[model samples]
Target: MYKVFFRICRYPHVVIGLVNITTGEKGYWWFSILHEEMLCEEYHVKNLKGVLLDELPQNGGWFDYNDINRI
Candidate 1:
């Protein structure tokens, strides 16, 4: 039951760098890098550092991946 929350310092999307902000694990760091690069070329307002998607909202909303693709 892992959950992620964002401080939302000054950005819309939270950027979870290579390091897992919670457990400090290693993986999906590329996601952060890619996001930064995107912001640079697209938004040009890179200042993201929030919660990762896989680590966010444990079904807090109406949709949860746990069963989405399972049918």
Candidate 2:
């Protein structure tokens, strides 16, 4: 079990990204503006390294994916 934290653009806080290496599953929590709370969503990826290198596109805007910290 591995957890990675990322700070996406426009959001003031960090989002928690979860990874299960054994199952090759990934997830993360984000603040849903409409719902006004945090929500979790699953991502299909091999590992954290893949997520950083391939899965998330580095767009220079509010949707930009930026790695902050991890645990």
Candidate number of the best TM-score: 2
After superposing candidate 1 on the true structure, give the runs of residues whose Cα lies further than 4 Å from its correct spot: 1-17, 28-36, 41-71
Model 2 lDDT tens row, 1-71:
44444434235543445455556566654432322121222344422233432233222212223433431
Write one digit per residue (lDDT tens) for candidate 1, span 1-71: 12222222213223232345567544321223444455445434444343234433222223222333332
Top candidate, metric lDDT: 2
Off-target runs (Cα >4 Å) in candidate 2 are 3-12, 30-71
**lDDT for each of the candidates?**
0.34, 0.37
- Report the C-alpha displacement of residue 38, candidate 1, in angstroms: 2.7
TM-score of every model versus the real structure: 0.22, 0.28
